[model samples]
Every structure is written in structure tokens, then in C-alpha cells.
Target: MAEAAEATAKTMLGEISQGHLECPICFCRYKDPKILDCLHTFCLNCLDGMLSKQQPSTGKITCPVCRKETPVPDAGLPGLLDCFFLSSLVDEINQQERSLETQQQATTSPTCDACEEGLEVVSRCIDCEENLCQLCKAAHVRYKRTKTHRVTPVEHPEQKEVPSADLSKTYSPKCQKHSNQEMYFYCETCKMMTCGICATIDHRSAEHQLSEITDAVRSYREEVNDVLKKFQKSKEEFKANEAAVDHARNRLKIMVTRACSAIQAKEEEDIAQIKNKSRILRDKVTEIGKKRDDEFDKVHTDNKKKMERAEEIETAVTDLMQQADDFELLNLKPKVMHNLEFQKNLQFERVKHGESFIGFKCQDVVRDKDLGEILHEEKWKLQSEFGKKGDWDGEFNCAAGIACFSNGDIAVNDINKKRLSVFTSTGHYKSMFDLNAPYGITVTSHDLLLAHCEDHVKVFDKSHQLISKFNLPLTGTDSTDQCFISPWSNNKTYTSGITVDKTNQVALVDKKTGVTSLHSLDGSLIRVIPNTKMVPIDIITNKKRCILSAMYDESELRCVDVTGKVNVTARLGQARPAGVCCDDTGDIYVTVHGNGLDKGVGEVLHFDPQGVFIGCVARAMHWPFGITFSPSGELVVADYYSVKIFHRV
Candidate 1:
């Protein structure tokens, strides 16, 4: 009985579900009598046929979904089920359209509804739902919208617009209790902004900080402007500094040019002086020579006249003899002829009574035998060889002085090597001497060596045996003060130079307070030579009286003749002179470094007896220090580094 009941319920449910969906035609469930007012329920193709009615001659119809009225009516039968989903879909479409409209409205946010203007309004009107500012608040807008809206101040911290759509919202921009209308500036001390009423009532008696906005703005501007001004000034100062550097560079260029010009001018002046001196000497010498020639000519002429007179007497004698012979055979007056000849000669001699005076004595001016080796231009060119080598075939630190031996050996003071090195002329090791920190070296003709070092002068014999030492007893070490030992040693303790005169006279550097006593071979102070105001850099005495001492850093290379009178002078302006030597002809050669470390500029200048500057013998050498002429007439230049040999021309 229950199963029958359930089946009956299922059948009824099916029947109800079948016609449950409504039809557009009758607005009711579909029935077997299919009607839409005309009883059409739109069954698939039949519904389309009915819907697409002929549109005035064309077959077209309005769609029910679009709410368009059909132009034709069809007599097709349909059920309610087919149009059910279409009705439900139409309901869903309408609902979704409303949701899309809502989303667009939310996306636009709240904006003014009334104005056409696009200005950004931070505040809004309550009643009119419009946005504006204080100046644009028209009373009519509020008054007209008063029925439905209200007006008030807006306050939204981050958002510029009013907190709500209505301008009637009130926000306290000021204190309400004070009822003050103006915005009082904040006082830093009080840390608050007060209304006028509050200022006069509550804050008037309180100590507080306050300032006008205009004054603060102005002060800030001034401070910033002051910093800007300083920056500008600094920029200008930097430019000035750069300009000064450039100016100094230009000045240096000018100074260098002027210095060069000065040196060149000096050369011209020196040459002119040499020419003048030579001319003067030539004039005097030529005048004297002409006088001698005139005297000789007169003597010759007188001697010829005497010879003629003798010849005439001879002829007269012959004639007298012949006449006597003729007078003996007829010879008359022969005795008177010979006597007259003699008397005539005597008379002529008396008339020309200057017999001795007629001839010149020239033995003093000429005829002196020059036996020494004379280097002439025709014989050989001047050749020089020099080199600095360690004394003991070891390393040399720094070469301070150098000297060469006669047999191709050279000696150098090795300040760094701490000993001297004797090397062959070709730079081969030979032998060396041991000594203290040596500063100077002088070689004697007999192979005796003299080296100057700290406070003592060590002397050595030819075979390198220690002979003895020379030193001044005065003992005080003051750099600024004058040295006493120097005057005694060199006649000046400034023993920068030492040379043994050919006669073995120990010559010391003087001209400064350093020179003093120079010892003899016997070890006693033979002489205490006094130093002059000048310091001699190098001292050399041939011993016959020609003491050639070259002065460093001075213009004069002075020579003292045999009479002790200093004559042969060489004037060199601004020349850093070093060593000097006198060749056989009395011609002197002086080495000029021409500015220390100015290696390429060093040259050797020759001077005549009258102090004439001949051209450079050699140039472009490394600080040519010591110079000497070899017995072979070769000039050896002892440079600080290398020794060069130039053949004397």
C-alpha cells in the first residue's frame, strides 16, 4: 500500500513539474491547449517561426528578450517547459546590470553633483552636495538646499575633501568656548596656537615665545643668502689661487730667460775684454818691436856706410899707390890720398856720433831659450783620459776627489767605499790606498800623496808607506765660527785644497780663515801662511814662482808670478771654477763645472797670460772637477763619475 502511494506521489510530482514554468503567451503554465493569448508556448523551431513574423515584406520579427512587439502572429503549439530558462536568464541579466552600475559608482568616489567646474574642492556643501571653499560659499546654495541638507566646516586629515558628502558637518578649526574667529599663530615657547580671546584671557600673563611670520621668513632668507655669498666668495678665491700659480710659473720663465741672457751677455763682454787686452798687449809689444827693428836697421845702414867708406879708402889707396908708382916713374901726392881717406872717415864718424845708440839691445825681450816641452798646433791634438775607480779594487760610495798616476793608474776618494781605489786608465783595478774619510787628494811629482780628512792631513810616500801627518792643535768644533786649524794648515784651516809645490813646498788653501801652517818634509811647521778673505778651492805651485790656484765660485783664476806678484788673471763671471793647470807656454787651463749638477753644461775654458777667455776646450761633461796636463800634453779631466781624456790641440 505504501509503494503504491509513493508511485502515485511521483507521478503527480512529474505532472506538476512539467507545466510549472510560465509562458509569455498566456502568462501561465503551458497546457495541451497551447496558447499565448493565442496559446503559443514557443516550442523550439515553431517558436522561432512565430517570433520571426514578416516585417512588412521581409521575414523579420522582434525578439521578446528586447521587449519589441512582433509584427506577426503564429498558430504554433508549444509547452511551458521551453521558455522557462529564458525567463530565468533574463532575471539574472537584469540583476548583474544593476551590480555593474553599483561598482562604477563606488569607483568614482564622492564628488560634487552641481558644478561644471573641475577645481579640486576639499570641502563640500551639506544641503546641495556641492564642493567649494570659504570664498566660494554662496549663501543661496545653502539656503536653497536647506530643506534637505545642512552646511558646516569639513575636517579630514589625509583626504582634502569633506569627511562626508555634506558641508553641514562641523569640525573645530578653532576653540569653540573662546568663540574666536581668527587663527592665532603658534608660539614656540607655549607650543600652542591661541585665539585672540584666549591670548588676552589665558596666555597674556604666561611667558611664551612668539614671532611674526614675516620676520622669521626674512631672517631665514638672510641666513641662507649669507651662506650662498660665502660659497661664491670661495669660488672666486679658488680662481685667484689658480691665477697666482700660473703667474708664478710665468715669472719663473722670465727669470730663467733673464738668467740665460745674463750669462750670454757676460760671454760677449769677456770676449770683448780679451780682444781689448790682446790689442793693448799687441800694441805695446809691436811698438817695442818696431823700435828694435828701427835700431837694427840703423845699425845695418851705418855698417854699410862704414864699409863703403873703407872701400873708397881702398880705392884711393890703390889710386895713390898707382899714382906714386907713376910719380916714381911719374907718381905724385900718394901720401895725401890715404890720410884724407882716414880723416874723412873720422869726420863722418864724429858727425854720426851715435854708434852704440844706433843699434837696439833686444836680449832682454827675445832670445831666451824655451827648453820645456812646447805643445804646438802641428804636433798633436790635446787628448784627455779620466775615470773614477775605487782605490782598492772595491766599491766606492761617492767620489769627492780624484788624481791620476803617471803610469795609467788613477786614485779616487771613496767616501762610500771608505777607501781609495787605484785603477788603470782603462778602468782596470791596480792598487789603492787606505785612509779615513778622505775629502781631497794631491799627487806630487815624486809619487808622494797628500790626502785631507777629518782634522788631519795624511802624507804618504811613493810606495804607499805612511810618511806622517799634519794637523793644527787648535781644537774647537763650531760650524758657524771660523776654524783656527785651517789657517795654520793651509795658512787657513779651510783645507779644501792642498798641493805640493814642485820644490816640495807644502801649499795649503788660504783666502779663508781655514788656512794655517804647512809642515815640511822634516815634520816641523816651515811656515804659517795666513788665510785671506777668499777661499782657495785648488792650489798648485810649479815652485818656480807660478802658483796657479783656482778659486771655486769666484771670477778670478789668479796666478802669482815668480816675483810673488800675482799677475796672470782670468776673469770668469758666474763660473763655478774648479781645478787649474799651467801648460809649458804659461798658458793656463781652468775647469769650470758651469753650475753643479749641470753636467751637460760643464766645460774647460782656456786663458791666455793676459786673462783672455779662449773657447771651450771640451764641453758636455759630467761635473768636470779636477784637471791636469799629462807629460804627453794630454789633458785629463777628473769628473765626479767618469774620467775623460782630451788631446791638447
Candidate 2:
């Protein structure tokens, strides 16, 4: 019981000592405790770093815990007073350590060597380090030669004394290589600890740069300070990283929440539309059934009237046969025969068309479009290729324009080859037609094809035969015969992109001067928008009739309305913006050159109608120049070598 009580008391004291020894800043035993104005204790070096990070304009330090502001003193953070309470606690702990050591030695105290009988000792002689009892302590001091031997109590024990010149003999550990010799030298060149003999032999070379063993102690202390600084910096970095990760996690959760809400809203709208359509069809069916029921009721009334008339004729014949003459009977027979023939004719006419009047035809109606609704199965995948550079009868050299028809056909124009090649939706070579210099192609109507040539747009039917040729009108002029050239040079002019709007108006860009011109398909100029601020390369239109053009100089896409007015423009963050096409859902796919993994290669990137980034559709192509969406929403890209297609998965 007494031992357990002692153990409990020791454990309580240890906890109390740990609490008093801790520094508030590092939460560890204090290195050099300092007191702040708020009486809060922290490590002096930790406080120094905290004060350094504060803005100089404040001229005051805010405590990290309590946020209490204190004016900066003339000597800065180092001027804070030392913590005397912590210092007293440290001293008490050291004294307790000494007492514990004394108690441990008491168990192993030697018996007095000079005593008559072996007895445990309580005093020691410092000169000889020998234990003695109280009675022997007096005699030991009374001895003439031993009186000046500096006798002390045996309760306290520490290191043994040695000669000053042979201080290496008192080393805590002897050398590993030479057990008899203490390691007293440090080799600066080898960066190792060595004994005196090894230093003179193995590291005896002049370039070895041997030094005193204490030199390493000084360098190690400096290295310890550097390590402490690094530890502090690492802690701060971890805190910052934790904060950034939490922020990103919260942002993603919010974005997902918003997307889910939008999806649910679209679902509700589609349900409402379906319900409305169902209600309308139900009412129409009821109304048609009532109208046909009324017609059958009229036929039933006519049959009832005929039955009454036949009964009247039978009663008259009975009356005439019983009392009247032959003349009266003959007259009744003629009327009855006429009535029977009329009833027979009516029955034949109504029964012949009974199938038509008996029931109403019900036809199924389908909704036309989905208003920007996202479907679960709408994913992208790659499809087949058509015209290659060396393929038989279907060769295209440096193709740069692509367009898709409603009949699931794809048309591409090769500027170098000067031909417009047609392909099936799944990328089968159909046919090709030659032109002067085809730059861009688009299906203007169901059967009409518009191809922008060197100086004019040539219209063609499905058979690749030229139907009409409309030369691009000169800017600020209306004459079809006159051609406009960039003021920079007459012969260096080129048009790279063309798009037809809902009004059969052709929008084309002059690549050299960045001017876009709108013209009618009948070779008439409407209006010109000058200084588009980007080198317009490819153009497309949204359902709202807004023209979106891909720019080459800054790798940006710009929007213009049908009135030839520029609206919003944004950079796509690619090395080169080559071609752009928007699907029915306002999702745009753009081809950018030099953004692929290999040099001079390219990729196709997707974006929304509002210019928000979606994702990448296809990647790592050999310079994809033009892009378009097939009727089924598959992306058709004009690679330099061949055509590439991506289908909705």
C-alpha cells in the first residue's frame, strides 16, 4: 500500500512538471522561454518569427491565440522579458533529477572498507570516492594526511575527477577502431570522428585537414539551428496546404450541387411538357368520339322513322283487305312499294361506308426538339475516316474545310487540291468535284451546296454540278464583277472561312485584313464589319443567328450578331485556334493546332455556347484544320492527311 501511494505521487508530480515545462508556441518543452505583455509564455525564437511576418505599417504585434495587439518596442521582439516562472520550474526539475540519482546510488552504496564490520555508508571522500559511516567520518577527518583530502557526503555522485592534461581519458565512450584510445580528433576533409592514432595514420595526408574534435561540436550546433528553422517552415507549409485542399473540396461540392439542381429542373420541365401533350391528345380523342356518336344517333333515328312508316302501310293493307274495294288496295300497294325501294337504297348506301364513319383515326405525334437538356447516353467516341492523301479515287491534299448535310453526308474542301470531296456520314468516299480554288464548304439548303472559291462562292447540287456562281462583292461596293483586295497587297489576299445563316446570308472573312463581309447567296453584298480585332479564320452560327468566328492571331473566338455587329470575344487558351463548330445544344468543338503532344500536331477542345470550357473531344491529330458536326451530332474534323470523325457515344 505504501509503495502504491508513492508511485501515484510520482506520477502526479511528473504530469505537473510536464505542464509547467511546455511552451505555448511549439507545444513542447521550452528552448528559451520568453514572457509577453499578456503574461503568455512562448519560445523566444518562435515569437521572433511571428513578429517578423506582421506588416510593418501596423507597428504592433497581434497575438496568434488571443489577437491582442501590443506596441513594438525599440529593441523589437527580442526585448521581451525572460520567463522567470519557467526558469524556476526548470531548476526544480533539475534538483529532482539530482535527488532521484542520489536515491538510486543509496541502494548500491558500498560498505565501509576501513570499518571493523561491513556497514552501509552515508558519507564519501571526494579525493578517493570511498563511502564511510558517521563514526568513521570523524576519524577520517582527524587523520593528519587524509584531513585535507576534501571528504564529502556519499549521497551525491557524479563524474570522477581526472588530470587536466589527460582530459581525453574521461571520454564517455572510447574509440571503436582503437578501444584503448579515446577519439580526440576530427577529420575535416573526411568529415568523420577519429582517434589520435588513426588521425596520425589513415588521415595523416596533408590534404586531409584534421582538426580538434571540439570543432565538430560547434558545427553541429549550427546545423541544429538550421534544422529547427526548416522544421518551422515545413509546419507552416503543411498548414497552407491543408487550407487549400479544404477550399477546393468545398468548391467542388458546390459545383456538383448546382449541376444536380439544373438537371432536376430540366427533368421537371420535360415531364410537364409530356403531361401537357398527353392532356391535349386525351381531349381530342374524347371530342372526336362524341362527334361520331352524334352521326350514328341520326342514323338510328332515321331507321326508327322507317319502321313506323312500314307499320302504317301494313295496317292500311289489312283495313283495305277486310272492307275496301280493289281500287283502294292497288293505290296502297304502289305507295308501299315506293317506300320499300327508298328504304333499301338508304340501307345500301350507309352500310357500304360503315367502316369509315364507325371509328376515328388516331395518329401518333412526336415532339421536335429538346431544349438544352442533357441526356445520360450522350458521350463522345471516334468513328471512321474517308479521303486520304494517297487513297484511290478519293485523294485530298491539305484539306481545311468541313461541313455536314441533313442527309448524313460530309463535304470537305482542299485548298491546295482545289476540290470539294463528298463522303457518307460514316466516312465512305462518295464523290468529288473540281473548282478553281475551294476554301470553305457548307450545305446551304437540302439540295444546294455552297463552296467559297478563290474570289467567289460557287453553288452546286447533290450531283456536284455547278448550279450558280456568286462572286464575293467588294467591300463598300455592290458590284459582283468588282473584287476587293487587302490594302497591304493586291495579290496576297485570301478568304479562309465561310458560314450561311438562317436567312440564306453568307458570312465570309478576309484572312489578311480581318474584315468580315455578309452577302446574299444571289451575289449581293449586304454590310461589312471592319476591324474585327482578331484575324478571323473559321466561322459558325448558333440558333439565335449569332456568328462565332475562330481567330488565328490570338487563339480566340469572337461572336457577332446578324446585323454585322461584334459582341463577345474570348481567348481559348490554345497555341492556335483553327476550326470551330457548335452543335444543336450549343456545345462547341474547336480544333487547335500545336496543342497536341507532338510538335506541329493539334487537338479538338469542347466549349459551351457561353464560351465556358467543357472538355477535350479528340486529341493528338496531325494538324486538324477544320471541324463540323454531323446531323447526328458527331464531330467531323479535317485532318491534314485524312478526315476524322467522332460519334456521340
Candidate 3:
């Protein structure tokens, strides 16, 4: 039992030494421990060293653990609150270690600090923090000044009871300047604990508002408790948010895995088809070559036979002319001439095969136009609609541009109302900020708002504070030519829409130049997309980094790569395409103003990433303009007068 108790004591001592007794900064046993307002404790000398390294003009020290700043008292580092509890703990730990060491050596208990003789201690004075022997204990009880000091019996080595510190006594820390006087008052102005002497000498002014330490502690505890409660709620919120983000991450990973598998399967299938086509093509070329070779052999044989007959006839005719009579020559002439004429008339079968036309016409496999597409089965339904035609706070007057924050909050640019209205994902109005005829708006990857106002883009922080503004590249149009272009306007000089990609690059459409251009966050021109012909109104980018632009005049939705290569173009027939957005799956949702039958009606069209029309998401709207997807994957549309939200089923 004694051995077990000793082992447990050693374990506990080790824990206390490692966890609480050591200073965080110096990583050693604390000497004159001080506690910051953030509740982190460090040695006084360590704090002084840290303060000396900081800018003295700040007059504040930062906690090493939490980085919370606390004002340096006028008395400096020594004036900081002393951690009495921790100091007592350290003292107790030291005493326990000494006791354990002596027990392991089989020596007597610790000697009494009061007596000159080397005597084993029997008791400890909690107030004086000293060990005492039997004689010293009796003297301590009899002495008038020390009799009131609380004393506890110290466990001897032979005793079965484990040694423990006397932690029940209340510790009153003394003032650093006035070492003898206990600090019992708190100065409101200085925000530091002080003794009676220091309060009278330094904090006696009316502004100081000196109060009992107990009262001050109670008020501070209540305030801290209130903040702690709020923090607890915030922690819960953060936990939920973290869980949601993790779930999304897992889902995305699973989707990526499945997509990889599908792509591999498709690749194998395409390779097999290509190989089969190659084999067939090779066999056809071989068959044509064999037929041509046979025809050439037959022609060569026939030509050789004709050449031998001509040579025999030539020798016979020459002999007849030289040696035979005229009559004999005449008899052979008719037959020889007939044979020559027949030979001359004979046409050896010409090889029918033309010059070798059996070669492969290689197509660009990298940018295969017929490469398969991803099928999106999303079915969207109208979830809710908010706002009406008015100048009220939540109301909208010509809702033009729409963008969503990372938290699913929606911001709409009401051009006619001259305000930027914000709403929750569920269509609940939150707040609105005034702006000057804002047309196109986009939320950057950092959640900064960039609103197009006339010739420049105004940048605002999350709090709606104006950070900075930059002018868009001059379109060579003067101020007189600069006119406000509505979503339905066919104005060529209008700066129609803006979007931010994953790289935080701003892409905008300039109808005047009939081109789409990319810009930096500060509105500096990066590069204009070459070969963009159709007049674009609204633009958005997908996860594939392909820019999707809505050509209002041409009634087409064109998908262009970042390098200005047109990938796909979906013709909307008579309907005019306006605002465009892409979902997480890279599927597109375009808002069009007319359905070929009714010019006043509007509908949201859904398309796959390859620009193939899937189906109509929603219809029978009054001129839908700007469209975007919320963080929750809900489709948000800014119609003529109100904002409509749709959910993917």
C-alpha cells in the first residue's frame, strides 16, 4: 500500500510539474508567476523579457498562448496580477518532491525551517508556508503572533497515508511594491489590483473608482461568464458548420472517384472503337492494293507477248524484203499488215486503281468535337420569391445583377432603386446598401463585392465598406457616349456583365467591341478574348474554367475557354438569352426573355456543361435578368421586379 501510494504521488507530481508548475515561455518552474487577463500564466521575468522585445509605445503586452493583448500597468510587468493559486501549487509540488526524495533514500522527513537543530518536520504552517518540528510546532501554538496561523499535520515517510498539499486555505497575494500589505482593492481606471497603500498614493484620484476586490471580481466574473456563454453557442455553430463542410467534402470526393471510374470506362470503350475502325481501314487498304497488284501483273504479261510478236514480224518482214520475190512479199504483206493492225488495235487492260488514296485523315483527338458529355439529371422547381416593384428597403426596382456569398446569402443589384439588397438563402431580407446605378455585380473568391457603376467597378468589403475602385479599360467612348444600358438594351457600348473565376480573375463582356475580356481584381486589363463576334450581355464561368456568355442579340449561349476558344454554342432560336450561371456539377442555367411565342414571357433554361439543352427549369416569368447559384446549390434569379429562388430536386 505504501509503495502504491508513493508511485501515485510521483505520477501526480509529474503531471502537475508538466502541466501547471512550468512556465509556458521559459518552459521551467515558474518564479514569481503572473496571470494575464486572458488567464494564461507565465513567469514575471519571462513576461518582462517579452515586453522588452515589443514596441514600448503600444503600452500593451500580448499573451504568448492566446495572443490576447493586455495593458501593461503603470508599474510595468511587476504590477501584473500574481497567480497566487499557481504559486502555491508550485510550492506544494516542490515540497512533495523533496518528501518523495527523502523517502526513497530512507532518510528522515524534511527538517524544520524555524529551528537551528536538524529536526524532522511534523507539521506545516499554511500561512507562513514553512515546515515545523515538534518543538517548533509547540512554540508556534504558544506564540501570540503565530498562534493564529493555520497549521496542518505533515505525513511522515512511515505513514500509510499519501502526502498531499493543504489547498483549503485562501491565498491573499501581497502587493509587489508594498510586500507586507495584501492587495484588497481594484482600481477601475488603471484596471489593476492594488493594496491600501498603493490605492492611497497612486490611485486616489476621483476617476480611479477604487472598489473592493471582491466586488470587482464578481463583476468581471459575470462579464466573463456572459462572454463564455456566447462563446459556447459560437462553438456549437462552428461545430455544425464544420460537420456540414466535411460532409460536402466527402460527397465531392465520392463524386470525383465515381467520375474517374466513368472516365476510365469511357476511355477504354473509345480505344476499342478506335482500334476496330483502324483494323477495318487497314483491311480495306490491303484489299485495294491486292486488286491493283493483280491487274499490273496481267498488263505486264500481255505487253511482253505483244513485244515478242512484233520482233518476230519485224525479222520476217526484213528477210522477205531482202531474199524473197515480190509476189512472196505481197502474199506475206496482207497477213503481216493485218497482224500488225490487230496488235496495234489490241488495248492491254489498264490498271483501274488511281494514285494511292488509302491514307488516314487524322482528326484532333485532344479537342474532339464528338467527345461524349456529362449528363445532368437535375430538376429545378421554384422554391420561393421575395421583393416587389417598389423603393422600399427589401423591395426591388429593376433587379438586374445577382451574386451569392459563401454562406449562401444573396446580394442583388437593383439598378432603378439605386441600392444593393441582400437576402438570406430562403428569400428572407437581411439588409440593403445604397449604390449608384449598379448594373453588374460579382462576389470574388475572397467574398469581396465588385459592382459595376458606369465606367468603373466599385469594390466593397463584406461589411459593405468601400475599399477601393478601379476604372474599366477605356472602350474609346467619351462621357457623352456613355449611357446606362439595361439588361434588355441592345446598346453596343454597354458593359453588360462581370464574373470572377476560381483564380479570382474578373471576366466581363463589352458589347461595343463584341468581345469578352479578362481582368485582374484591381480592374487592370489582362487580355481580351479574341474572335468573340456575338454581342454578349451576361457572362459566367464554370468549374472547367470555361466562360459561358449570353448573346442577347444573337439569341445564343456560347461557351468559350479561357483562351477565347469557342467550345459550344446553343442557339435559343427566337428567345434572347440574358443572364447565365453554372451549378456545382458544371451544368448551366440560363435565363432567357421570350420563348419564340411570347416576347413578354421569360423562362430559365437548363443545359449540360457541353452546351446541350437539357430542359426548361422554370417558365412564365416577367423578363428574368441575372442568375446565380447559392452555396446550398439553390438557383437564384433576379427577375424584372422581384428575386426568385429555385431548388434542385
Candidate 4:
């Protein structure tokens, strides 16, 4: 019974020891322990094994329990000292174990596990893990094999409290490769731990930077802290850049919304005015028709009365001649004659020929010069004029096309001179350069210009140097690089009026064939826009994804949408449109060449989007060809030998 009871006591004590003193990794008694940033304790050898296994992938020590990353310190894992509190607790547990063994041996009845001897215990042999009486102890010492074993007296007269021991400092780890040797050093070059035997054999080379495991651990801690600070700073910078980009995006949205609202309001006002004018003209026509109908009815009634009197007199004369004799007929002759004379003298009212009787007059219904007054074009005052017949810049010499740059500079294509002339926004000539029969010029970018020349498109830089050229294509050609000129017409090349769109596509028209073509930036023809019935002279684009072509031969403008479909064809009765442009409000402006060089006069005409003639915006010039608007919506025109600028008052 005593033996069973003693066994029970020892089992309870061992369970308590394992709970406080064992290393979690190896499930053994604690060895050279260290603490991590998360406050968890691990054996020194265990830390080295974990870092070696994970460092290649993570480049840092990852806590096994919490999965927190810690940068490996330069001094390495062993430089971290054993945890003081945990070490002290382990020491206390060891003391308790020894004290419990002594108490079991001192009891009146006890048995030794090693010798299986029943005795009254007098001493305990720690090495043999057995209890011994006086006789057994003497025998234990006399035995040659057991003499070196340590024995302790079981009886102590005074009772003393056992202090807690630190298990972290008490443990020593054995090498897995060489189980008999303890791991004592670390190889920095190989990032591995080694025992004393391994240090002399495997790690003996000069290339292996051997270090005391503890020293390397201290260096690792310092590096970890430094890297953590850098990571935090980078995260803050990324957040600030994101906030700035979001702010700019929101501001742009607001700007677009306000601009669209103002444009829509102006559109509504112009439409209302057009409707009111139509109503007035319709009412005037109705009143004239009603008055003419009343006057015609009165004339019809008077003619009917005279005809009835004549018919009555003819019937009475017939009855007198048949019934009465010669005497009766002669007596009725005078009366009949008087009646006939009355009928003969009766006349229908003569219609007035000088005034409009029933039809509406064109002058009353359509406003030509008078439309400018309604739109308040008088407020659009002239800013300046240059490039005139007598100007020092020299006459334009048949300028055919004009374009405005983003920076407010102006470029003109002088077909007669075969050169391009550039001027400031205020009409001061900047420079001129030779181009082969330049017909159209447009700014593809701030520094690049695309010019339509005789049979090819030429690209030029801001310095007026020709950079590249490509021939315009025609049908039955293998590529867009075909160049051909018909013998019948010298100017019947593949290109005429040209413009660049927001998408960087070049749109040009064939003047002789009336076929419009869209080309890629690299001079490859994408597709041909269907030809319109009227002859296309000049082309301009609006923000509505539509292009307007001025028909030189017809008194009309052709509107082509982005899909290459004709949207509308409208006529402005008198003006012969040579060049066309549009403002932000979709209001079109055209330069008129009324009767050619002999009698033709230059006039800038304005019209609404629907082709209702708004009026002549400008008049009384030699002849105007190309018309455009500045960024501020000011009118700019190439008047044959002059360039003119006009602005709103």
C-alpha cells in the first residue's frame, strides 16, 4: 500500500513539472530560452531552427503562434538572453522534484526503484534514483561500479522553503546530428547552428564566419527595428498620393457639368426665337389670303347680275317676234336695244397687279441682313486686320485654309504663293515657309503641323522643317501612298480641304470627285466617307461628332455625322459658301465668294444649325476663302489677300 501511495505522489509531481518547465517546441525540459517581441518564450536552439527554415522564404522571423513578422537581427537569435522570469520558474520546479524524492525516501517504509530493496530509508542515491538504508548505503559505496554515484541523507532536522528556479538557464540542448554534443556556435556565412564537433570538422574552413550564437542574436534585433520603421513610412506616402488623385478627378467632373448646362441654355433660347419668327410669317400670309378672297367674291356677284339681265331681254324679244306681228317686233326692238346696251356697258372690277395678293413674299418671311441685328452681331466688333494688299507682311496671295493653334497662334495656307504663313493671334506675321501648293493646314499637336499639299500630306515641326510626307490614296491603288494628277485638271489631286479630329484622324475631301476620306495618323486610309451630291470645297468639325462640308458649286452646306452618314443638307439661298466653320454653340459661319474674281465680294455669313440664315456676320471685302474661330469664339477669316480678326463687344 505504501509503495502504491508513493508512486501516486511522484506522478502528480512530474505533471506539475512538465507544465512549467518543458520547451513547447521539443516537448522536453526548457533549454537556453529566449523571448520574442510577442512575449512568447522559446529555446535558443528552437529559434535558430525556425529562422533557418523560414528565412529564405520570409526574410524575417515569423512567430509560430501569432504569425507576426519580425526582421531577423544582425546579431542573430542566440544573442537574446534567456527569459529571466521563466528561467527562475524552471529552477524552482527542479528543486521541488528533488525535495519530493528525499521526502519519499525518508518515510518509514520505502522501496528503491533501482535495487528493488525494502528498507527504512537513510539515504537517497541521486544517480541511481533509489532510496537506501544504512546497510544498503554502505554496500552502495563499497561497490566499485557505484562508488562515484552521489548520495544524500534522507533526514533533515530543519524545514526550509524551496525558492523557484529559472529553467531557461538550467537547460542544455543536444545536437540532432551529433546527439552527444551540445550546439555551441553559429556559422554566419551558412546561417546555421553547429555543435563544437561540427565547428572543428564541417565548419573549420576560413570562409565560415563562426560566431558565438548569442552574439549574432543581438545584431538581428537591431536590424528588425530599423526595417519596421521604413515599412510604415512607405505606407503613408501611398495614401497621400491616392487622396490627391481623387480630389482632381472630382473637380474635373464639376467643371464639365457646369459647361454643358450653359451650352444647353443657349440652344434653347435660339430655338425659341426661330419658332416665334415662323409664327409671325404664317399669320401674315393668312391675313393676305383672307382679304384677297373677299375682293374676288364681290366681283363674281356683279358679273352674275349683268348676265341674268341679258338672258331675260333675249327671251322677251323672242316671244314678241313669234306672237305679235311685224308691228310688235319693231316696238320691242328699241327696248331690246336699250337693254343690250346696258348689258354691254356692265364691266367686272379690275384686279390690282402691283401688290402681293395671296402669296408670301421671300423678303417678308426670310431674314438675310436683318438677322444680324437680332443676334446682336453689332456687338461683335472688329479686333484687327493684317495681311492686306498693302501690308508689310505682304498680301496672302490666295490663302485657301486657316487653322488656330492652342496657344492662339494662326496658320494660313497660301496656295498662290505655295507657302505657309504663320501669324500671332493679333495678326502680326511671325514667319513663312515654302510648301508645295499648300491647300490646308491644321495643328495636329502643339509642335506638329499636318499640311495638305498637291498630291501628298506633309508633316512639319514648329521650326518649319519638313519631317515626313505621304501620298494620298485613290481607288484601284494597293496603298494610300499613290500619287496621281489628272491631265484635265491641275488641282485635281487626292487631297483638298483637310482637318484633324480629336482622335488624331485626318479627314480630307477630293475636290474633283466629291468623295470624303478618313485616314489614320500613319497615312493609312481607314474608310471613305460616302460622297454627297454637292461639290465639297472646305470641311470643318463640331463637338457634336459631325463635320460640315461647304459646297462651292451649290448654295448649301452638307452635314456628315461621325458614322459617315449624311445627317442634313441645308441651303442658305444667296451666299455661295467657300469655307465653313462652327462655334461652340453649333452655329455655323461661312465665307462667301459671290460671283468669282470679276464681281465676287467677300462676305462672312452666319446660320443656325438647321441652316436658317442668321445674317451676314461680315461684308464688303475682296473675296474670302477660309474662315475659323479663335479659342475665345472670336471670328477669324482669310480674305483672299488679308486676314481679319473680330471679337464680341
Q: Quick one: best lDDT, which candidate?
A: 3
lDDT of 2 by residue, 205-290 (tens): 98998766556555543543453454445444434333333332333333333334443444455645555544444344344434
Best by TM-score: 3
TM-score of 1: 0.37
The order of the candidates by TM-score, greatest first, is: 3, 2, 4, 1
Instruction: Give lDDT tens digits, candidate 3, residues 378-459.
Output: 3567889998988888887678789999988899887766788888888789988888634488999888998877557889
RMSD of each: 53.9, 40.4, 40.1, 42.6
Per-prediction TM-score to the true structure, in the order listed: 0.37, 0.40, 0.41, 0.40
Clashes of 2: 2
- Give candidate 3's TM-score: 0.41
Candidate 1 lDDT tens digits, 364-467: 12123211121112122334344444433544434546666667566766544556667666656667766663336777777777886655678877677887
The whole-model C-alpha lDDT of candidate 2 against the native structure comes to 0.60
lDDT of 4: 0.61
Off by over 4 Å in 2: 1-378, 476-495, 530-534, 563-565, 595-600
Error of 2 at 260 (Å): 18
- Return whichever of 3 and 4 wins on lDDT: 3
